[model samples]
Target: MTFKSLLGGAALSFALALPVLAEENPAIEQRQGQFKLYVHNFGVMGGMAQGRMEYDADMAQTAADNLFHLTRHDQSRLWPEGTDSMSVDGTRASPAIWDDLDDFVTKFAALQDAAEGLQAVAGDGLDAMRAGFGPVGQACQACHESYRDEAS
Candidate 1:
């Protein structure tokens, strides 16, 4: 029932679920690939935040670093104009993304800031990790709530 044990299991599960073959759209393939990574790291950090797993400073810091780096990359190429969920069969990208790209980019900026903030404090201690985790989680929620479809 420890977090490390659960994280190991979750990592195995996520590893199996990772897609290897290309999707119909290259953008979808790449986007989903990137998101799978995000999900895995975020899951580890979340486990620590929730006390669902024992906190390992190394693991927490590693996950925070991964998330922070991932957000730093330019993902603009992954979201083409016509690839919204309404048009694509394999993605949850909402049409709203194309409608207001500025807001979407701003949300990603928030995520980058939050992830960077978490990276700074994750290895400090349980209390620091717990404290810094909030904004990152909230940033993710904000973007998902606005630009991702729940239908997937």
Candidate 2:
């Protein structure tokens, strides 16, 4: 195969591998892994916004883009039934997540929207990023308050 064909095959393989569903216990771990990625990227933006980290437009844009991608990622398998904190150890997902999945998904969609907004403005300037920051944080807080168990 040509070099470009090889690279295309690899990319296609990766894309096809992304959607396999996990079993219940493994689903918890999968979702946790996904959340860790979200936290890591979001923390970069948060640090910049709070002045805890120096603002770099390229880094901010990359982080915002990663967060946007993550927020839009399909994680239905990662949230399989019986994966909540009450059923699974080492998780902070409340059973309420399953009880009212539609509302939970609505809240997630709101976060996705907020992340898109951040992605659009994150590299514009500190002022622009700061303006976009609050909505993302609020969306996260709203979902966590309703769906996630408090950290011990």
Candidate 3:
């Protein structure tokens, strides 16, 4: 392999190993994993919406349900205090989250509401998917704008 590729591989390996190497908090890892799960399901619906992937009814419904399902969990354990971006090495959770958790939860409730709407129309058609996904996307953006790191 070329030197650039070799170096790139090493960099990737190091990035993937960052939590273990840094001895970071487990709550950070858990919450990050939960967000990754959100991305995985949301990416599927987003791909269909963007025409990057062929729209399939079953996949759309499943992805929408899974995304909404994530919203139903308690999620308290994943967000322990001292795990904000200011205090943690690898987290992107903003300090603002702890500043007013009730408001933060209200934002999350908006996501839940929007995701439920998306799940309702997920299998209807691409146009419906587009319409439904817009609110869900907006909900996520609203929360991220307030409580997520730009780099995250």
Candidate 4:
């Protein structure tokens, strides 16, 4: 092939690879930010649920309900149809998530269950509410240990 044609082909190939090469996309950034926000809210709600800080029953229940709703919504959107080659802050979500999709789904489903249970029990009373909070905290830690950035 002519040198000019070869150069043109090479340029085209490079351009095609640009998206992957950048390792950053606005959509990914936005999603990552949303996930971080979810984590923060979860932590805050969990703290209240655990009685780490003083919080009224109504406030605790509201937080728990919000956390449960957001977690389910975010998980559905983030894991849609299985994804690979998506990482935020160096979290290489293990391939098992897609390979063993059923297992991942089960684990996340358990998390949802815990979150919902926490919400249901949140306004019951402080001691009973704290009892319910344990599982929800465990669920977050379980997913994070497996799927998220440990450093973060």
Candidates in descending lDDT order: 1, 3, 2, 4
lDDT of 1 by residue, 22-121 (tens): 3678988898999999999999988878889999999999999999999988898999877788776778889999999999999999999999999999
Residue 104 of model 4: what lDDT? 73
TM-score, one value per model:
0.83, 0.82, 0.82, 0.69
Expressed as tens digits, the lDDT of each residue in 1-152 for candidate 2 is 89999999999999655533224367777788888998998899899999999998999889899999998889988887766776656678899999999999999999999999999999999889888888999999999999989753
* Worst-scoring 10-residue span by lDDT in model 4: 80-89
- lDDT for each residue of candidate 3 in 1-152, tens digit (9 for 90 to 100): 99999999999999766543113667677777788899999999999999999999899999999998998988998888777877666677899999989999999999999999999999999999889999999999999999998664
Model 2, residue 49: distance off in Å is 0.8
Off by over 4 Å in 4: 1-12, 15-23, 49-51, 74-77, 80-92
lDDT of 4 by residue, 34-122 (tens): 56766776666667665687767887777778777866774455553323444333334554576677877777888889988988888
Tell me which residue pairs clash in candidate 2: none
Candidate 1 — worst ten consecutive residues by lDDT sum? 15-24
- What is the TM-score of candidate 3? 0.82
Stretch of 10 with least lDDT, candidate 3: 16-25
Residue pairs in candidate 1 whose N, alpha carbon or C atoms collide under 3 angstroms? 3-53, 3-54
Question: How well does candidate 2 match the true structure in TM-score terms?
Answer: 0.82
The number of the candidate with the highest TM-score is 1
